[model samples]
Target: MTPSAIPGPIDPPARLLMGPGPISAYPSVLRAMSAPLVGQYDPYMTQLMGETQELYRGVWATSNDATLLVDGTSRAGIEAAIVSLVRPGDRVLVPVFGRFGHLLAEIAERAMAEVHTIETAWGQVFAPSAIEEAIVRVKPTLLALVQGDTSTTMNQPLDEIGAICERHGVLFYSDATASLGGNDFEADAWGLDAATAGLQKCLGGPSGSSPITLSERAVEVIRSRGRIEAGIREDGDASAADFVRSNYFDLGMILDYWGPRRLNHHTEATSMLYAARECARVLLLEGRDAVIERHRVSGAAMLAGVEGLGLTVFGDVAHKMNNVVAVEIPAGVPGDAARAALLEDFGIEIGTSFGPLHGRVWRIGTMGYNAREDAVLTTLAALEQVLRRFGASVPAGGGVDAAADVYRGAA
Candidate 1:
């Protein structure tokens, strides 16, 4: 194929991503990615890496010394945490409530752990007692789960679950990929031994560079069995016979790269590092608590707006995530057709639900850079038009008016 046969230089469409994550990144975050590059171990590059690590410490609400960024998306952070800490034949327990919970179990299985799971219905979260019961029954070495699952738009409560894990002598880990920045996550206070998250969701960046943290205990588990990567292995130290399977996803090696020793791992993704740094910087500048509250209000507005359109909401509302809402697609409306019209005509994109809830609910997100009054109102207005056009009887201006009332009340 000739070069001209390929597409021209990428020109993506302008979109308001009122969906579940990879939402529009903050303009500044995108600009940060375009900054000039530096050599991997250049003093300034390492300085930026260290600064980025410290920034993530604040974002994760942890003081753990092993906090750092994983090179791939949020899933890489999760895989690293599991494969590094969960040895083959170790018993792992996962409390399942949504698709991401199942995802954790799948990853744990691939890591060769003996995985056990107790499930709750979709659109709901497991109670702390339920999780404790599973722990007692499974007596697992680690507990893997997700904090916010975009699939169900549910936020599992972790505070009591963490305490329960401690009582049962199990390591606690959660993928906070969809919840970290715009929702309340207290890694240290809530007793999370390991937490991994991505830049795409509430962090207001693209889907690369996973920020992760490990408690002293979680770090100890990894260090006890971990071998230095072959690339940086020295003559004196011996490599482990059962080292982690994937070198690139090895948190132990990645930590050495991010840690004070500055051991060479892979050449870091420089552009992603800059973007991750900027995402954390922007959120911290706004204040983490402030960001959570902003999402709460914005998400509530979106929820109320959807309700005003005479829509029923999916899920257990009390435990629903603050960054996304699941609206039940109206009975007569063509769900995907309405979605396509919203995208094509209004340049707005709302997500479809996953798994059991697929085609039953439309997931709308007011997350990351799009978590705002204007975004909520704009999406509601566009959604109302699409709903009406598709033969659903939506009240004219109902969505926007309800959202405006929410903003007024909030102010």
Candidate 2:
């Protein structure tokens, strides 16, 4: 473990990322991250932050002024929104459909909010009426949920859920970390109070930074707790809170860093901001619709391929996420062994399920830059070989042929 004992530099072997997140970064994004670094307060760096915000606003489909990047990963953005908005004793209602929903509940608990949950079976989404019933019963101050749960590869229906929150006067927040860039999301139209996402999964970038947007109401709630310094106060000025708890995750100060005032918070993560910017740039240049369409087609191909491999898909087929698929493990097949073989022999990575789905399903991702014909074909072909080796009765060339038909239809 000593320095001299350390081995020489090693290059990474190329592999297709077909897991939940931190998916393969695009070549352009990697190059952007490697560009020369600058001081935190450099004018060019500030401009980069501004442009990054603008880019995310378009991706989020919102015009909120409070859009900015959280320095850490996607979870940082989740904590920033929840801790900033939910005061102690505030009622926060979370809907538990998958593991990520439980994550929201856990974070809200850490923030000292009184948490309530509307529970649903994994791989299933709550109906609008079900959510409305819970909201009316609990009268929660805040409602937090995930747009897509990568653990189960299911996208929760949002349009009606947003409406229910609005009707009940509850603030709506969503974690779109798994769905953004690959699926359709409309923050403003969907009436989201706050939405946060990461660049790694579908945005074709690394996982160091998070993109977040706050609606007007979300801004107002955070502003109520804004801090004011003695030196900065004037005779007629309004005083603010003495200390905003959790300084590092404070969105108010983050807003200041992103706003016209341009105050310092943490030194902006230069490489991560550059990567996030490039991710957005790639999506924008491709046109948002085109990017979404690409995910749709690729996901369809993946679905057809998996089915053609003589495996059954889990969950309601219509409710699946656009970038990830869940397939049931065939009877008597060693799921773990198949996945390991896919990685070791074929240089492809797929995900295993969690919670109730443990040992029951294999999750495969078709996301970001990896959502292409070649990636899909490679994964399908590798999976067929592995399954056949494991004694599954997969027909020869069936998976590849089915996927080819899907691609042909798209063309």
Candidate 3:
């Protein structure tokens, strides 16, 4: 256990990540993280930060001035949005379709809000009518939902839900961590008060930064709860018991840090800032619509290829995200063992299921840099061998051949 006895420098095996998330980052993102760091308040750093904010505005399809990155994972962004907007005793309605929906409710509860949730079957999503009924019944101040839940690979329909919230005079927020970039999301056109996403999914970056957008109404609510810290406040500054519960997650303070005022909150995460900036730059440079179409084609190919291998896909095909898919584990193939074989034998990594689907399905992802024709075909080929080795009957080259047909059709 001595230092000298340890292996030389850090090194990792090359892996083709076809999992639900934390996929292999784009080469440009990795390189961006290694760029030289500068002082937090350096002019160049501030300029870069401003540019990142603008770039994310385009990515989120919003005109909100509050669009920026949270210095943590996607969950941090979720917490920041919920805790800042919902005060203790405030009523919040959450429609639970999968694990992440439960997460939104939990974070709201932790912030001392009266959280109410309506549930649907895991493989399905809530109808617009169901959500409207909940909003009317709960009379909540906020309607929090997940746009995409990787656990079930279901994308909740937000297009109509936003209008439903608007009719009821409620704030609408969504966690698009797994759907953004690969899917079609319109923050402004859809009437979203707040939305958050992470870069690891379809943005082809690591998990440190979370991009968030807040409509003007959402900002006004957050502003009412703002309380400047003692260290930064001067005489005549105001404080109250109703200040945001967690200073670190207070969107008001974070906004001040990112805004033109340039107030010091926390030292900005410099390296992650570079990576996030590059991720948005790459997406915009390629054209957002073109990137989404690429994901659609790749996701379709993966779906067809799995069916070609005689495996059933979970969830309603119409509701699935264009990034990840869940396929039922063959009747007798040891699920975990099969996944391990894929990793060790072929240097590929697919995902395992959670909750109700555990041990029943394997989650395969075609997202970000991995959402390509070659990645889809390679994963299908490797997965076929693993299934056959595990005693599941798989036609030779069936998966890859079927996936190739999808690519050809797209061409």
TM-score of each: 0.97, 0.96, 0.97
lDDT agreement with native, every candidate: 0.90, 0.90, 0.93
Per-residue lDDT of candidate 2, residues 87-149 (tens digit): 878899999899999999999999888999988888788888888888899999999989999
Cα miss at 288, model 1 (Å)? 0.9
Q: For model 3, state the Cα shift of residue 54 in Å.
A: 1.0
Instruction: Give a tens-digit lDDT track for model 3, residues 1-411.
Output: 999999898789999999999999999999999999999999999999999999999998988999998999999999999999998889999999898999999999999999999999989998899999889999999999999999999999889988888999999999999999999999998999999999999999999899999999999999877475775543245554367888888999999999999888899999999999999999999999999999999999999999999999999999999999999999989999999999999999999988899999999999999999989999999999989898999888999999999999999
In model 1, pairs of residues that clash are none
User: Clashing pairs in model 3?
Assistant: none
Per-candidate alpha-carbon RMSD to the true structure: 1.9, 2.4, 1.6
- Model 3 sits at a Cα RMSD from the real structure of 1.6
Model 1: per-residue Cα lDDT at residue 318: 98
Q: What does candidate 2 score in Cα RMSD to the true structure?
A: 2.4
